[model samples]
Target: MGEFKPVDLFATRRDWDENPREAFRAYVGSIEFVQAGKRGKNGADTIRESSAAVYISMFERFMTWIETRNRSFTSVTQEEIKEFLDLRDENGKTRLTSKIRMVYVRLLERAYEHLNVDSNPAKNLAVGREEPFRRGKEKAKVILKVDDIQRLMESLPAAPAWNENSKNKRQRGWETRRNRALIAVLIGAGLKVSEAASLKLRSMKPKRVDGKIEIDLEIWDGTGTGMKHTAVIEQFAVPEIETWLRELGRMDLPSDLVFPGTIDTADELSKPTIYRLITKTLDLAGINTAHSGGRTLRNTYAAQQLASTNDIGKVGEKLGHRERRATEMYLDAAKKFAEDAV
Candidate 1:
């Protein structure tokens, strides 16, 4: 008898797992989520990113509040939601804008569903709250010039030790080197902090073909807990990127994670550790993330790509956006670049 490959079994059972939700539920059940739900006072809420337990707890609280106040779910109308929004301003918490109101309204909609209401009062609620400020007023600020980026990187050769409690400097070591590389990659590659952390060792491979070596990035935005493929590239011209990959010895194993935590013992890097890397690197460079952040890197990538080519589609594709229209800001910058050059 020959050895059976895992792919053969998968091929054979391909039709067996047709219903994705059932398969997912089965997987979740296998992982004890279903059992945990059973143990709880009520079945899982499975709404508004709330767990069944949280839903039950909240529902219990809501019931108590309504009963004590002699109120009904029907009594809560759209006007009440509007009144709540009004109170948000009265309480000096004016940050509750239309987007936030929509979220609150969504929560109320879910509440109505759970309460078995005929209609969600929040449905007719208009998100007419004027943005606290105009889009012009909230324009993105350029935090780092090309020279500033260079100087900042030159300053932070390693992550500095900072005492969270005392707010003082400490010692630096290999961990410092690793953190520096992580930050450099985020800025150089314009990767999200989470994406940088989740980076696999194999995905950072530098391919050599016909005596030419080019670095590549294999991006993944996993879907439904299944590993998702986002972008693949043979682009980017940063020497430090290749140097860091070589230094880390992650040039071979595609399955291996790139920015792995020293203490994780897992395949991929921890998100918190990556966040700390960003903060520590910024602190060492004396850069404030208020302006220069992971998001800034993303925006920079979009802006630079757009300016260089004046093609929104190409930049959008590179940035993993499904729509070119989504890259309008980048396109707008590219247009400005064209005008400025002329």
Candidate 2:
């Protein structure tokens, strides 16, 4: 094991003038020690420099809040924690999304445990599930319609232009094939952006189901922390993926990343790159990409599945959701659209 370098929490503190930086530093150091040498979900040591930096930033923010109120970390109450989160949301300092709130709560819980302080103030604080179609939110209808999806797919290049031999032309050719395959997998297989980005060539296998050939995609959920599951791509998408694979072979590119960025030799495409590709494709297809990006494809898949099968459970399964209610929003939206059509 490599020597664990201590994180400098004070260096990342943003509210140094209003808060006692030393207090946050000590609190974060104690938490770091408690988490040190622990095995993470990925079977590696829990303590990482990147994770430590993130933890310090979150803790520093919270401790700054406590200090501004002339309160110590050990003196905080459940009500105060809730108020802090509310302030964070209201001030637009942070969106206070469920995921962000959960991170904050986890930090508090773990910190309390490390401090041997009973009655974790952040315990039982509800961070609601993310809703796709929340009422009164103009952003609810983010999913692309089936026709829009078809048009978007159609706008993409069928194959690389064969005659363009320039360096830029060759790069564009590879990008087109890669991006098309990336979008096909996202929409057809209903994979999350992270899942699609992390897909490797080895994760895809050709299989025979009922004497019919199909491509089984091994998707790693929760950034590879969750269990690996296989999702068969729709027949419509197999051709594009196969073409992309052939292009990769022709270029003598590494087969490690199914969709490698132009400069990404690490066998992975970043999420932002995937988002930009989807947005650019949508724009080229004459569809509005505002407030809509990669997740729209996944949502479109879920909506189509629900509309066709009228089964929430099945839609949830197709979307790789562990909970049935995760599919409910799509069902609700589908029903509402149907009624509006009447």
Query: Number of the top candidate by lDDT?
Result: 2
List candidate 2 segments past 4 Å from native: 1-97, 113-141, 157-159, 162-172, 207-227, 336-342
What is the overall TM-score of model 1 with all chains considered together?
0.52
Q: Tell me the deviation in Å of residue 213 in model 2.
A: 8.0
Candidate 1 local lDDT, residue 320? 59
Q: Rate the local accuracy (lDDT) of all candidates.
A: 0.48, 0.62
Predicted candidate 2 versus true structure: per-residue lDDT over 102-215, tens digit per residue: 567666776555445567676555333224212323335466665776787797756655333444424555676777888888877778887787777777776446321233
Question: TM-score, each model?
Answer: 0.52, 0.61
Error of 2 at 211 (Å): 11
Tally clashing residue pairs in candidate 1: 5
| Candidate 2: 10-residue stretch with minimal lDDT | 129-138
* Residue 183 C-alpha lDDT in model 2: 88
